[model samples]
Target: MNTKGHCCPKYVILQAVYFKLRFTLSYRDVEEIMKIRGVIVDHATIQRWVYKFMPFIEAEMKNRKARVGKSWRMDETYIKVKGIWCYLYRAVDKSGNTVDFLLTRKRQRMSAQSFLIKAIINNYRPRVINIDKSGSNTAAIKVYNRRSFSKIKIRVLSHL
Candidate 1:
């Protein structure tokens, strides 16, 4: 959250970043918002701030997030993002709290594996994982287990 060389105050930059991320507004919309608040900033500057500070923001949010359950349910689905088709991989604890999510351009074992790694890193490793009958998911879990040498029980649900 360092604003070392920034021309505006930290709060102003944060407000612009929050508005852009917390809503569906475009960069120009955030620029207009700053203008309404008497801050003369450009949309491109807001975009730069988001790109610069997003990682730090994500790390802070992850640290503040509640611990997930030991049991998890993993799934993936095809979704349209920015008019492009992509696969969204997600995991939720048994109590229905989200663990983590990732959007990938393809539905494959590598994508699933990367999402699993990210989820495990952000949250504790689950004791059990229930997944739909997707061979890619199964393969990813197997690879993870083999590499980590940790026994994480996997249950394949026939019906998604």
Candidate 2:
């Protein structure tokens, strides 16, 4: 909070954190912008704030008092990490809020299992999972004791 390079210490640091969250901007860019606004904080300080706050943000996102609804839409998106295509799995609850997410390179049994494990462990497990019609999903359902909708009401999903 000793950010006294002509910048109001708290405002500059708070703006840097807010900007980083709202937009995927680099720490240095955020630092420069704060400097332009008459605030002077190092990029490393911004990085530290983000690193410390990210977990709390994720936890708040995951542990809402409302469990949303039973219907869950699960999907995988492709993103480049280190120039490699990484599969990011995500889910939206019935209320259309993001529930959980996972990132992995392999779309195999282990990846699916880990995603499900996290979802189940951290929050309410969706009663219905609407994932793509893929072999991995098929195996995942089996591995996690999920069944077709006509089967188990607690862990039913699409017949893929």
Candidate 3:
């Protein structure tokens, strides 16, 4: 594949993408790091590289089959994006393998239901789902169980 671009080498572009993703660094931070390595590049260029390479990376990742466990731990947390608060729902298996994640604007039952549905569909049905004592999550699980034939056990943890 043509990894090299007109202005930067493939290694430099991949380094910027790796820095931006593997760490919580901004595009400007990645640019600064590349500059420290004597590679002059703009933050916008780095952003473009990330946007361009992400789809290919995701496709490569999806090609690999994941061996996730049957017991899953689900939770939701608030994240700020562009100064706006959003909810991030995440699920991990018993071995701490990432099952799935969904970002949404609302923290209601519908949001929880959608997140669970997506997780289940993507990672396959789990035997047991552990969650916090959230009423929305509980209600969403109930709704999911009612609609789906494969019933999953829900375990509410007092502290997550």
Candidate 4:
């Protein structure tokens, strides 16, 4: 294909980058497949494309859908970053796709509420929230539910 007038290399590269993200494929694998199709590209080039186009993709996707849907599930995991404890709360929608995430220093009621509020700001507030029996989660829900705010939140707790 010759682009004598409209090359649109940005569009072409964005398409390739989106393909990589959709499948979560490794860079080397993408490079090899593109090479097999006679498209000369490098894994480094793919990485560059990903870094360059991520903001645009995020903006567009956020514009299209800005809600976590009705049924959302949340879980927390602890990780040590540089020997400092970090708590990560990840929420997923009904279909199992991730909706929101939060990293905090404390695993208290405030942290849980912050994560929930962050998720609500980005996505629509969930009607049903499934969380563990952590006191933080329970407390956050109780506070939000009894609040006089415009959007009172209700959360359902479950554990293993």
Predicted candidate 2 versus true structure: per-residue lDDT over 1-160, tens digit per residue: 3345533455555667788888999999998887898777799888987786667666765566566566777767789989999988877787887777899987777787778768766666666777776566556756677543333133335552
User: What tens digits encode model 4's per-residue C-alpha lDDT throughout 1-160?
Assistant: 2223432366567766777888898988888877876778888888877886788888888899745568887778899989999998888988887898998988888998888778877887677777776777667766766672534444556552
Candidate 4's TM-score reads: 0.55
RMSD of 1: 2.7
For model 3, the superposed segments whose C-alpha errors exceed 4 Å read 59-66, 75-90, 96-107, 130-135, 146-150, 153-160
Q: What lDDT would each prediction earn against the true structure? A: 0.93, 0.71, 0.87, 0.75
Model 1 stretches astray by more than 4 angstroms: 77-88, 103-106
Give lDDT tens digits, candidate 1, residues 9-78: 9999889988999997999999999999999998999999999988888888878999999999999999
In candidate 2, stretches whose alpha carbon ends up further than 4 angstroms from where it belongs are 1-11, 57-67, 75-88, 95-97, 101-103, 130-133, 146-160
Worst 10 residues of 4 by lDDT: 1-10
Model 3 Cα lDDT, one tens digit per residue, 1-160: 3674359888777788889988979999998999999999999989988999977766766768587999999999999989999999899999999999988888999999999999887768889999999888888888999988658899999889
Clash count list over all predictions: 0, 1, 0, 1
Instruction: Give the higher-TM-score candidate: 2 or 3.
Output: 3
> Which pairs of residues collide in model 3?
none
For candidate 4, give the lDDT of residue 148: 29
TM of each candidate vs. truth:
0.79, 0.61, 0.63, 0.55
Arrange candidates, best TM-score first: 1, 3, 2, 4
Name the candidate that leads on TM-score: 1
